[model samples]
Structures are given as structure tokens and as C-alpha cells.
Target: MTTKANFPAAAGSVVVPYGHVVGNEKWRGSEIAQRLQGKIKLIFEDGLGLVDFHLSNRICILYISEADLVAGDDFKRRLVRFRNANSLGGIVIVERTQISDQYFIAVQKLVVLELGMVLLPVANQGEASQLITQLVREQSKDHNSNPFLRKQCSQLLEASVFRTVQQIPGVGKTKALLLLQQFGSIHRLCNASVKELELVVGQTVAQQIHTFLCS
Candidate 1:
């Protein structure tokens, strides 16, 4: 069993190699660990402090069982302690069976809003195993592969900006394009004088643009 003293408490210091998960030794025979078999590589380590699983060097998961909710307050303290002790991103996996449904809202507020950690509820260990597998896969994927992380096309960005400029009252596509060509960007256009804007658009449209931006 690996003791707490064997490793640093700072989760960022722990290096989780690709395509693997480090689980707490206590979970070695647990349903979650068992179900995770053949899905991804799982390695057990002792005294991982308050974390139940390490998905990566920067992210660790804390499992809260139905019994933990029933028992009350103890799990809250553990979460707070983990937050205080480590700089890693903590994902709270909660078992939300019918018996534990009542505590969901309160747990959500504390784990997500108060503690600023992610809280994901699962029906059981099997569900948790599946979720963990997906999370691991997502973490392993290249940043560019995620649509949200990918660089947007320049043409799409220019069209979007053109549309935004057109949304101003009294401004149409011709004036919007003229304004963009003069100013180069929304920020410069917003900061432009009514007189400067009149160079591209008329006095009325320039005042309208100024009012829309400033007011």
C-alpha cells in the first residue's frame, strides 16, 4: 500500500501516463474498479489522500457513496479538506440511488457552487465505471480534436463579425462592410468618432452606431 508520505499531496505533481487511471487501493476490489476492467488500464495505489481516482495529473475524482450522504457532514468535510490540500481539479462522483435522492440538491450546491468542483451523479458503480472510461478517453484526446478547442476558420469569424455589425439599428450589410473595411475590427469601430464613421457611413447611421455601442 502506498502511504501519503510516499508522494506529494499536490495532485499536479503526480504524473499519470497516457491511457491509464490511478485508483485508491481501498477500491481495488470494489464494483467500480471491477467494472472498469478491460475498458482502460487501472492501477491501484494506497494513501491517495482524499481522492478516489486520478484521471490525469491535473484531475482527480472523489467518490461519495449513498451511505456517505445518509451519514451526513463527513463527506462535506472531506471535500473541503481535499480542496484545501490539493491544487488538482476535483470531480465529485456521487451515487444517487432512490435512497440518496433527497440529498442531491444540497450536495450539488456544496460540491459545485461552494467548492467549485465538478459533481457527476451516477446510478451505481457500473455507471460510474462507464463515465470514467468516457472521461479518460476525452482527456486522452488531442486538444485540436475537440470542436470547442479547435481554431475557428477565419472566414466564419469574419462573417460572424459582419453579421454583428449589421445588427445595429439603421446599419445594413453595405454600411457594415464599409465600416469594417474602415475600422478593421469591432473594437476600433466602437471607438471611432461620429465624424470618422461618416467617412464610411452617413451622419445619421454613424450616430446610430455610436449610440448602439456607447449607450
Candidate 2:
């Protein structure tokens, strides 16, 4: 119902403040929107276009009701149009009631594989609200708090670098350590001249290292 140009700034870049969500005007009093009000800050805006909800600047949601699924391929067309028009990561939330369960697999394949977007199934709007709340909570947390996003410490990085250096032909722990001391990273080690490498290992091994890396 809304157009892309009506957005505040960039396309698909809905700047939602922390612990808040921007919802489409179409869902002003919908059950999911109503439920979300108690859990997080829900702000209604017009011209959200294909997005039903904006979780963050980079993430958004497109809701497909059970009726939409049963109606025909209109939901698919809507998803395709959204994919073509927006750069934001879309999360498709579909109502998966017993009646709509039959179409779940087909919908999943279309939304996930073909469209390359996330597809989440909910029994009803209540469940959808709960899932959305969890998603917003996760998004609000510090990235380090998430196990998948926790940064690899320098010690682990150095160990990984150490192992990678040993993979070079004819280089073992001692030589790997020597080369690492001379060249702090694999990029520098790969770029080292034979004369440069000779400063770390002997001239004979240096040539071998240079050839192994370059060739």
C-alpha cells in the first residue's frame, strides 16, 4: 500500500531506536502489533511498502497470513517484489495453522532457497508476537553476548596463524615460529623475498619457501 520514496532516508533503511520497532500503518491494531506494544516500543508509520515491521536498520519482516497462503500465489508475488525492490534482509513470517500447514514446505523453499530470505512459521499471531519479541531482544543485545558473534581473541588468532604457517612446504614449528617473528602475518610472509626469508631461515630453505608460496 505504501511506496518506497515515502521512507525517511535510504531505501529499506528504517532507523529504529533501541528497544523499539517501526510497524506498518496497516497493522495499527492487529493482534501481533497489539501484543508487541507491551513488550517493546511500537511506532506506526505509513509507506512501509512491502515491510510489515522494521526490527532494525538492516532487518525487516514481511508477514503472510493464513488467508494469504490459501488465496493463491499473491504472497509469492509480494515477496518477489520486495526482494527486487529492497536491499534490507527480509524475514518472512508466515502463519502456519493446521489449514495452512500443507503449503509450508513449498513456501519454505520459495522464501528460503529461491528468494534467499529467512522464513519463520508461526501457529498464529500470538506466537508470531512472541517470536518477534525474542528477535528484537536478541538484536538489542551486544554482539559479543551472542556466541556466534563473539570475537576471536588475539591468542586464538595467533595460534591459527601459527598452524597456517606450518602448512607451507618444508616449514615446521621452529621454522614457522622464525618466519612468524620476521613476518607478522601470512600476507607479509607470502610477499617476503628469498633474501628476506633467508634472514629467518637459511638460504636453501628460503628459496623453497619463496617458491612454495609464490608458485
Candidate 3:
């Protein structure tokens, strides 16, 4: 829904702290650098670094391979600070591989779901770059249109309501919130017929919800 002009021009306008590319070059260098060369700012630092991918001004992504979870406490701390910050754009953790049950559980409870950040498992570096670019462009759009950022910024009560409605297939945060605003509750929203929902939302979304409920 956003225009290309709204997207980051080159290497996103952010700067990665120095040393972010030094020791971890194997996982963090070359391909990642090329993808982000003109897409984000890769800063040089004399001190220790925190995040591996700085996609935008508000959101920074941390990388975790299957083997690197245990030694990432510093990043955990930065994530906490970012979570508590007033800035709306939240953290996104990009896990490079399929991790163990314990690692997944630890990340889910300690950071991802609890701290209000997104954790995505990407198969390769190329996918990671493309995904980050997509997210960055989406974040640049209006708040009403950027569902991910909207959900991230929402309060508990509203978030719960949105999540409930979003469970319907093809129902994103915007449409879910709109449906709730129109119908008042999930019971009422679900009870509405396709025609009734179409009157409020659109043909596509109404059909999607109807199909989902009926299926």
C-alpha cells in the first residue's frame, strides 16, 4: 500500500556501529554487506557492537544462528532497552537456522513474544535481506497502513482484540480493527453474514473471513 518514494533509497539511512562487521564476518559479512551496502548505514565503531542488522532508525535486527544463542546476552540487553524506548519501531530477530526446542522456547519467552518483538527464521542470507527491505519499506508508510508497526505499538487491550480478529484468514490488523470498531465484539463480528461484513469491509476480506469461518 506504500509508494516506492516512501521506501529507503539505499542501504537504509541507518548507520551500524563499528566493529559490528569485524569478528562475526562469517555470518554477518559479505552477502549481508552487499545487500545492505546502499540500503543501510554501516557505521564503524571502536567499541563493542550490539545488533547485526540496522534496518532503519527505529528498528534494529539481531542475528542468531543455531549455535550462537547461548553467547548473545549483550544483544539481549540492547533489545530490552529498545523495547522500553518510546520509539515505536520494535526489534526483529532474524534466526538463520532452525534451532532446538529449548532455544526457541528461550527466545519466545525471554524476548520475542514477551518483549513485543518479532522473531523470524530465515533459511539464507538472501531471504533475510529481502525480508528486511520489505519490512523497512512498510515501516516507512503511514501508521494506519503499516499493520506490523501498528500491532507492535498497540496497547495490551487493543492488541488482544486485534489479535483475536486477525485470526481470521486474510484479516490483517487494519481490517480486524475496523471490523471490531464496527461490530463491537468478536462474537458480533463473526456472527455477521458475508454481505453484512462486505458493507463494512470489502468484498475480498468479507469473502476471506466467510470462507475461513465456514471452512
Candidate 4:
């Protein structure tokens, strides 16, 4: 069995290579280097700013904060599309120093963590890459240690109820498992009332699940 310590670590310190771009000559070399000082610069070019960061051997990091300038809704939609399409390993939002909103603050924090870049709080592309590499290493450790967890994960994959529970408003896979584990069967779970389900899976999810199952 693969152990946690056997997980591969990210590259330590390597001199980044120079990149080629067609239209942007002035933005090359030291100018781009200055913008990417602390990061392990994988690729940087001026025209359209095609920057790719080394998140891990299997994953790469990409940022779309610049995309936000196009259209807030469109940017968010495109960001999701890009992430889904490109298999973007993580996401980070860099604020423009001028705007400050509590709503965005919360969102920023949530996105950073969800993308596995908790260490890169401010969301610099370089830092986000490094954080993602670290997260991959940590997740590798978690993946190795818990065989029972893996078995449960595989069982969930085969069971449509796992996916169905996630689609319901407030119920996630975790709560779904808790419900199944406690009830010992989905039939029992379906029979559980809103109040009884609430005791196992939180009131909000329980109520939603009750409506879903009863309906």
C-alpha cells in the first residue's frame, strides 16, 4: 500500500525557462520576471497574458480575475466553463486594491479554499500554484491512509442515491452517508420524517429531503 510519506513533493527551486510570444516583445524577459518574482514562473507572455503556473505534476493553476472586467456574470460563467473544460486544479481571485466588499471577501475566501489554495490567501497566480502543489501532496496523504474512507467513496460512486442527495438543496454526500449509515438502508431513510431526518442530517437538509422523498 502506498503510504502518505511516499507522495511526491513539488519541485523545490528551479530556474524558470524563457517563453516566446508573437506580438509582445517589450513585455518579455525582466519586465515579466518582475511581475513573477516569488513564483516558480512556468510560462509568461504579454499578449493576452497567457500565464500557466505549476500546481502539481498532474494539475495546473489558472486565474480569471482579469476575466471579471468583461462582464461580472459572463466572467463568472466563463470562469466556471474554463475550469470545467480545462480541468483547472484550483482558482484564486486577486482584488484590484481599490474595491472592497464584504460579499466579495466571503466569496474570495470560499473559492480559494475550495480550489485548494488556502495558503495563497491574496491569490497571486504564482502563490496559488505553490499552494495547490502543497494541497495535492496533503490530499495524497489523506487518500492513502483511510481504506474504509475509500471503500465508502467507491460505494457512493455506485449508488445513485449519493448523487441524488447532493442535487437536493442542502444535502451533501457527507450528510447523505450519515443518513444511510444511521438508518442502515435507504428504505428506512425514505421512511424517516422531517424531524427524524433533521436529527441525523441537519434541519435544512432534512426538510428539503423530506419534501424530495415525499414528493
Task: List, residue by residue over 134-154, the lDDT tens digit for candidate 1.
Answer: 878765676334332122223
How do all models score by TM-score?
0.63, 0.62, 0.44, 0.36
Give the best candidate by lDDT. Answer: 1
The worst-scoring run of ten residues by lDDT in candidate 2 lies at: 147-156
Winner on lDDT (2 vs 3): 2
Q: Show the lowest summed lDDT stretch of 10 residues, model 1.
A: 147-156
The alpha-carbon root-mean-square deviation between model 2 and the true structure, to one decimal in Å, is: 13.8
Arrange candidates by lDDT, descending. Answer: 1, 2, 3, 4
Give a tens-digit lDDT track for model 2, residues 1-215.
21222446445666776677788888877888778877878887777778888877767889999999999999999999999988777778889899998887677656653565666678999999998888777666764343311122233335645654565667899999988887876668777899999988888889887876665
**Per-residue alpha-carbon lDDT of candidate 4 for residues 69-135, written as tens digits (9 for 90 to 100):** 3335554454455444443233333433234233343333233312222112333435443443343
Clashes of each: 0, 0, 10, 0
Predictions in order: lDDT: 0.75, 0.74, 0.53, 0.42
Per-residue lDDT, model 3, residue 100, is 40
In the order shown, what is each candidate's alpha-carbon RMSD?
12.3, 13.8, 12.1, 12.2
> In model 2, which residue pairs have backbone atoms overlapping below 3 Å?
none
Q: Which regions of candidate 2 fall more than 4 Å away from where they truly are?
A: 1-10, 143-215
